[model samples]
Target: MIRAATDTGTFVPRIPLGEWVDTAVDWVTATFDPLFDGVKAVFETLYDGLDWALATPPFAVVALVLAALALWVKGWKLGLGTLVGFVVIAGVDQWANAMDTLALVLLATLVALVLGIPLGIWAARDDRVSRVLRPILDFMQTMPAFVYLIPTVVIFLTGPVPGLVATVAFAIAPGVRLTELGIRQVDAEVVEASRAFGATDSRVLRQIQLPLALPTIMAGINQVILLSLSMVVVAGLVGAPGLGAEVVASFQRIDVALGAEAGLSVVLLAIYLDRVSSALAERAPVARALAAAR
Candidate 1:
C-alpha cells in the first residue's frame, strides 16, 4: 500500500520522547534531589520517633484524646465513629498500621496545603497562570492513583515517605484549584466595600478574600485528605506499609479475610477524616463561609 505524502511529509515517525523524558528526569533530579533527600531524612527521623512514641501508653492516650476531640469538635456521631474505628483497627491488629497510614496522610496533606495554598493565591491573582494551571490540576485529579506510584517508585524508592510524596503530588491539585476558585468567587461588592474602607490589596486578601474563601479552601482540604487516603492505599504496592501494605499482602496471599479487614480499616480511617474535615468546612462563616452557603 502506498500513501501520498500529505501534510505529514516524509512521515518521519515522531522522535522518541525517551530522550526528552530522560532530560527531564536529569533536570528534576539535579534540581530537587537535595530537597528530596532532606525530606526523606526528616521523615525517617520522625517515623522512628513516632514508632517509639507509639510503643507507649502515651500513644494510646493521644488516640483517646483525638477521639474525644472529634466528638467535641464535630459531634457525637464522629466521636463515636472515631472510637469504633479505632477499636476495629485495634481488633484487627492493624492499629499500628492504621496509625502509620494516618501519619503519612497527615504529613502529605500538610505539605499539600502548604504548597498548594500559595500556588493557588498566585493563580487567583494571575489570569494567565490560572488558565495554565487549571488543566494541570484537572490532569492530577483525573489520573489514576496507581499510575503515580510508578514514577514515585523510580525516583524515591518504596516506603512510607516516598508514598507520602506521591500522595501529596496526586492529591494537592484540588487544594490549589479550589482555593483559587474560591478566592476568585469572592463577592466583588464586598471587595469594593473593603477597599472603600481604605484596605490595601494585602489587607483585602488577608481580612476579606481569604476569610471569605476559607470554607471553600477547607472543602478543598477535605478533598485533599480523601484523595490522599485513596492514593496512600495504592502506595502499598511500593512498600508504603500500614493497612495498605496489609491489604496488598492479603491480596498477594489470597487471604480474603485479611484483605477485607485491611480494606475496612482504610475505609474507617477515610470516614473519620472525611467527616471531621467536612464538618469544619461547613461551619466556616460567610465573611468566612466560602461556598458553604451554597
Candidate 2:
C-alpha cells in the first residue's frame, strides 16, 4: 500500500492569510471605486503630459538639453557621456521607448517623494509614528518586488497605470526611511537653539532642518530614482511601455540584439541619473548656502 499524495504523517493547520487579503482587497475595491478612478485620472494626465513633453521635442534637441544639464551639475565629462548615450539610443531607433521609460521613472519618483518625504518627517517628529512605520517599511523593502504587481493588476488591470502604481509601491520605502533618518540626524542642540530664538516648529524645519538634511534627502531621492528605474522593467510585464517592454519583447522572441539595445539604453539612463544625483547630494547644505548668499 502507498500513502495518498494528500496524506500527511502529522496533522497541520493551514493559514487563510491569502484568502483574507483577497477579501480585504475586494471590499476596498468595491468601496473605493470613485477614489481609485480619481487617482487614475490624475495619474493618466500626469503621464500623458510627461510623455508628450518628452516626445514632442526633436531627439537632438532633447539630447542636447540633457547633456547641458549633466554638464552643469557634474562637469563636461558627464555632459559628453550623456550626449553620446542618447546618440547611441537614437542610432538604435529606441529613442521613443527610452523617453517613455524616462517619463515613467520621473513620474514614479515624483509620486514617491511627494508621499514619502512627508511621512518621513512625521515619523521623525514622533517616536510612535517611527515605531509604527519601521515594521511597515521593513515589510515593504523586504517583500519581493514582483509581489507589488499582483494587487495593482487586480485593482487597475494591465497597462501603464498598474505598472506605475506597482513601481511606486515597490520603490517608496527608501525615500521615507532616508528622509526620517536625515531629519533625526540633525543636531538636537541646533533645534533647541532655533526654538530658543523664537523659531516655530515649522520655521525650524524649513530653515534649519531641511537645509542641513538636504544632502541626505538628496541621497534618498537618488535611491528613489534608481529603484523606480529598476521597477520599470518589472512593471513592463504589465504592459508598461519603454525599454522594459522592449526587453520583455526581446525575451519573448529570444532576440539578443533587441535585448542588448534596450539594456544598453537603460544602462545609459541609469548612469546619467546616478551621476547627476550623486553630484547634487554632495553639494553644500542648503540652508547655509542660502544664509551665505544673504
RMSD of each: 3.9, 3.6
lDDT of 2 by residue, 232-266 (tens): 98888989989999999999999999999999999
Summarize candidate 1's per-residue lDDT along 107-188 as a digit string, tens digits: 7898899999999999998999999998998898888888788666766787887788889999899999889989999999
Error at 142, model 1, angstroms? 2.5
The local distance difference test score of each candidate is 0.84, 0.90
* Candidate 2 residue runs with Cα over 4 Å from true position: 1-9, 284-294
Q: List the residue pairs that clash in candidate 1.
A: 285-288, 285-289, 286-289
Off by over 4 Å in 1: 1-15, 30-32, 47-60, 287-294
Q: Which candidate's lDDT is highest?
A: 2
lDDT of 1 at 238: 93
